[model samples]
Target: AQSVAQPEDQVNVAEGNPLTVKCTYSVSGNPYLFWYVQYPNRGLQFLLKYITGDNLVKGSYGFEAEFNKSQTSFHLKKPSALVSDSALYFCAVSRNSGGGADGLTFGKGTHLIIQP
Candidate 1:
């Protein structure tokens, strides 16, 4: 089955500093990479995705990710951090075809803490 792994349970960063949260994935075919953010007791919000183009992809809230085939990784990054950016982050993968209705699989979660 296609799956994603978020090794870290949490990340702490200072406000206005760059931040990152790591993710790795496994799938049968070429993986579709996605990043999502979640606030306290709220549903996840879409961040970015890597379908089949450039390795580096940008997304909402000034966030971005790099897709690395060799490392099987899709790490999320931001140039600067904000206290409002402190939230739960999730990495996801979708099958190339016919995997499921939505075909999305998500990681456990990673809590990002941005200190002011």
Candidate 2:
């Protein structure tokens, strides 16, 4: 079984400051990690994914995450925060392609609030 944990229910940051949304996961075999963001009433948008490659992976909107195998963590980071970046962020994990019964298991979600 695979699972993800978002310890923080919300993260508050100033518009110009940097922000980070933490995430940790547990899984059998190699894990496939992903980040997605959702705006009010809109569908979730894919932010980034870590399948295999460099430890640090970059994604949309100047967001990046470091895949720490030893720690079993994938924490999302943004060098500079923006008011528009405020949204519901989710961290997910799966051992496979995330289909059928083997679908991706998502975290409860972290509300990123960027105050301008």
Candidate 3:
């Protein structure tokens, strides 16, 4: 079984400044990591994912994440954040079982507050 951890309950970042939401995971084997964001009154939207190959994975918006196997971290980052970027972010992971991926194990949501 795999699990994800988000150490911060909330992260405050100034608009136009770089933002990072920390995420770490524990699994028995190679893990499939993902990042998702949810706006007020909306469902979680896919942000980025780490399957294989590249260490840096880019996705929707200006968001990107670096997969650090050594540290077991997959922190979401954006070079510059916007006020509209404020949302609840979640980090999830699932085991990649040759056939397909298993159901995701998600961490407690982290509120990313982008101050104007």
Candidate 4:
């Protein structure tokens, strides 16, 4: 089955410091990877995606991710963290257009806490 796992339940980082949220996936054949951010009570917003080409993909809000096929991982990163960056992040994977569903399969999500 195609699935994504986020080993960390939460990530705490000081403001202005670098931040990372880990993600790993299991899928058949090549996979379609995606990252999403969710604020309080709001729906998930699209961050970035790795479909074909480009191992390193940049996304909204100064966020970026690198797709590593060997490790089957895609980790989200930011050069500097901000208080506003504190939110829930999810890593998703799709085997074939939504990974068999109408959409992708999302991880449990990691709560990012940016301490000022």
lDDT scores in order: 0.92, 0.94, 0.92, 0.94
Question: lDDT tens digits, residues 23-79, model 4?
Answer: 999999898899999999999999999999999999999999999999999999999
| Candidate 2 Cα errors over 4 Å, as ranges | 95-102
State in Å the error of residue 113, model 2: 0.3
Model 3: per-residue Cα lDDT over 1-116, one tens digit each:
68899999999999999999999999988888999999889898998889899999999998999999999999999999999999999999986555663678899989999999
- 64 Cα displacement, candidate 3 (Å): 0.3
Q: Candidate 3: where are CA atoms >4 Å away?
A: 95-101
lDDT of 2 by residue, 1-116 (tens): 78899999999999999999999999988888999999999999999999898999999999999999999999999999999999999999975744645677999999999999
State, as a TM-score between 0 and 1, how close model 2 is to the true structure. Answer: 0.94
**Model 1 backbone overlap count:** 0
Q: Residue 85 error for model 1, in Å? A: 0.3
lDDT of 3 at 72: 98
The alpha-carbon deviation from the true structure for residue 84 of candidate 4, after best TM-score superposition, in angstroms, is 0.3
Give the true-structure RMSD of model 4.
1.9
Error of 3 at 59 (Å): 1.0
| Runs in model 4 lying further than 4 Å from the true structure | 97-101
